[model samples]
Target: MHSASIVEAYTVTIWEMLAVFVAGISAGTINTIVGSGTLITFPVLLATGLPPVTATVSNALGLVSGSISGAIGYRAELAGQRRRVLRLSLIAAVGGITGAVLLLTLPPTAFETIVPVLVALALVLVVLQPRIARAVQRRRERTGSPAHPDGGPLLLVGLLLASVYGGYFTAAQGIVYIALMGMLINDTLQRLNAVKNVLAAVVNSIAALFFVFVAELDWTAVVLIAVGSAIGGQIGATYGRRLSPSVLRILIVVVGTFAIAQLLFRRFG
Candidate 1:
């Protein structure tokens, strides 16, 4: 009987390890390409029978690790964006801290209701990405200008708001961030994506630190996910520039829609 129990335990552990590996790879790809990787990992964690809050906090921890890896993979692209990054990092940090605190203090019922709304908003933004990008491109072309004053202020505001969202739930956060970046920064798409990874990492890392001390976390799951996601991030960053923006944007829309639908079903059904 003792031997059988031990064998079962090992088998379950191996299954979970495989699940986390798959989640990490999916997350890394989504984070790099479209930004809804949390949707994949978070649900998997929940399905594993962890409490909702525990799953969320653990997911955040795992994602932070992945984001850090992704940021490092894009280090070269981060060079010129230093000033912009510095300007926004503090705001994102603060927002993240606030969001983490909210999660710790708020009731699960409230969070459940709000999540769907947030998902809906993220979907809208994802759908509008290409249109917004084209408008920004056109404006830049019309003026024969490389920079615009409106862009920076808008970006700061968007970053602060998005950081709050990301720090809290963070499903589809990348699409929103990428859309905002496309509108604000005149840099190459690859460089903008690098910025996105750094900002996301900053937000999630700050929140994860808080959760580490205040909330219950599944450390084993975090380790597996982090390792897998880090590998995925490197692969995505390497080939991200080769992808077509239009196709990527459409993919974001499709995923965002599915996320929103899932939320709605969970809420109403």
Candidate 2:
């Protein structure tokens, strides 16, 4: 009887791990393309029976690898943007640390009411992404003057605020980053996107280090996500641009809908 139980336990664990891996792939890809991958992985982790807090921490930490992979895959687009990315990275790191501290210290009760709303908001952002992008494009065309290459204080302040939010809820942060970039700086969207990936990765990387040391972690889940995210990030960075805008919009809607459902039906679902 003992042997049978052990075998069964191992089998179950393997299946759970596989599910996490698949979730990570989807998350990494979606995140690279539209910036709300957490809506995919976070819900999966919760459904796999992890407590909300544990799953959030693990998801945050595990996705760091994916961020790095995605950023690296965008290296071609990152040329000439080194100084800009570096300047913003320190601010993101500090904000990320602050957010991690809050997560560690605050009680679960604090987030219970707010998390669903935040996730819902992220879904809405994903849905409106194309409209938002087009609006920025039109605004730039109307201005006829290139926005500052090095944005002034407004850009710095915006990045700081975005990083703090990322450290907290951490969904759709890329959308905020890109919006700020598109409006405040003169740059191609592709290059701005590459910068967004690296800066967000820095914030997450700093927060993940803290979580690894300070929190109760599930290493098994972390490793599975990391591996899957690495693969997914590369696929997204390479082929994601080739996908039609309509296809991307459909994917975001599907994932975002699932996220809303999961959050609404938390206990029973």
Point out where model 1 deviates above 4 Å: 1-5, 114-150
Residue lDDT tens for model 1, 1-269: 01247778688767877887899888986787667788888878876677878888888998886788788888888886777777778878887888788877877655557666665665565566557767878887998977753257778888788788788877777767876777676666567777888888999999999999999998887887888888888877777656666666677678777777776675687
User: What range of 10 consecutive residues in model 1 has the weakest lDDT sum?
Assistant: 1-10
Worst 10 residues of 2 by lDDT: 260-269
Q: Write the per-residue lDDT of candidate 2 for residues 104-140, one digit (tens) a residue.
A: 7877555546555655664565466567657756887
Best by lDDT: 1
Over 4 Å off, model 2: 1-4, 109-146, 243-269
Candidate 2 similarity to native, TM-score: 0.80
Model 2, backbone clash pairs (residues 3+ apart or across chains), number? 0
